[model samples]
Target: MSPYYVSYKSDGTLVSGPGSITAIGNQTGASSYNNRTSGYLWCPTARDFTVGSGGNKGTTADLATRTASICYMRGLKERVEIQTSSGAPWQWRRICFRFRGNIYGASGQNSQSGNYQTHIETSNGYRRLLLQFTDTSPAGNQVENALTALIFRGLPGTDDWYDYMNAPLDPTRIDVCYDKTSTISSGNTSGKVFRKNFWMPMNKNLVYDDDEAGGTESSTYYSMHGKQGMGDYYVIDFFKAGLGTTSSDVLVFEPQSTLYWHEK
Candidate 1:
């Protein structure tokens, strides 16, 4: 019997399937893939929803709102396994996620600018990866306080967020890969979509080796095996709290928004 399954609610209806590569990637082609190391997450466009204004400035909406869109990936606790140098077995807990989405003003404006963020919760809601907008000073004296902050946090048996910025690896320094604006036809109007893409740097310090008894603890290791949990299925929340008052001025999650990851 198959051991893995993924489930999520779409338009108040529950949908589920085996956690196989074909299923997870929503592939419509072959029965299987030769490369099982990577696949696309099965986030349906029907599951796509919007967040209104008046949310917390730098965070998502309340837990009740987040829980409504929660997705579950069972049998992921041990999807990837490895062995330490001491012959002890270990599950390499790393899977990188690539998020592709768009930002646009919900109002009928031809242009849009806003503070947007993507929040990913995993480990049964104990761990979080927050991809905030980056506030940078650009040319022409432009300021971007509207930009969000990228951060990682965990719940160490408490209700508070345990910051991971001070860690030696510095996982909080996430960078964007692509961002551009283009015009597209939306029904009868020529609408625009601001496409933004993000992928974590592979140079992160997620792997540690204590092979030498007295060697200095080093943190310069990189590998696909060291990627974090995209396999566990993530409850991803997109929030837009722009500095505007128009109810039409909102962030839109495009139907093409996707999560790509490598598995063991």
Candidate 2:
């Protein structure tokens, strides 16, 4: 069986698939990804479930996941070449993800430290990766406080929300190879060919948080805003928080994760 990670509900029920890339499953009170094959993902678009611990879609939302057993992708850095004869062609696109280690879930309470982000800056003589959002600022590096914070509703704020600037596990960094062709003898150019490379460390457990507005601080509902912090965009203390404090404590068990993709 393919190695994988598994997430659970606060009740300790099966949440994500550690063996199969099922569809994003749903939890009544938390931000857990429901492992169904077809349906509305937590992010609102059609969920793109897969077989292994990875999916092919590039959009955020349920597309990203975490489990204690995130090692499914350990030692895997191969470029996910856009399949030429993929039965699902439209699913091909630029994508990237990374796995974190020793980390735990985040809490909305006191979320502002031990975090890091970087981007590329253009105005500088040499292009280099800086903090996230800033990587594209100055024509490259940027401080995307906007992206730093996210009030993710079921459908871009259409339904109840699980988080509001609750630091969800974000990629430490992302790199993309866009508008290219796949590496194959019979090159298929019907769609765009892109590749995303990710780097992850097994040391730091990038903990994220959610401060539920309803005062229901269930582990299952971790980082979720309960529906009160709606329409309010938080200025994510970008490049912040993860001090291993009482609140920033990473989960004791393994944090599960999957290399998700959109396969349409």
Predicted structure with the largest TM-score when compared to the true one: 1
lDDT of 1 by residue, 1-264 (tens): 111122221210111122111111122111111111111112111111122233321113322122122222222121111111121111111222322222112331211122222222222321112222222121221111111121133332245432111212213433232222222122322323333333322222212211233653312111112243221122232221212112222122222223221212
Query: Residue-wise lDDT of candidate 2 within 1-264, one digit each (tens)?
Result: 233322211111222221111111221111112211111111100111222223332222332333221112232122222222221122111122221111112432222222221211122111111111222122221122223222121322325432222323333321111112222212242323344443322221222232234754212111222222111111111111112112211111111222222211
Runs in model 2 with CA error above 4 Å? 1-4, 7-83, 86-202, 210-217, 220-264
Candidates' RMSD to native = 21.9, 21.2
TM-score of 1: 0.21
TM-score of each: 0.21, 0.20
Global lDDT scores for all candidate models: 0.21, 0.21
lDDT of 1: 0.21
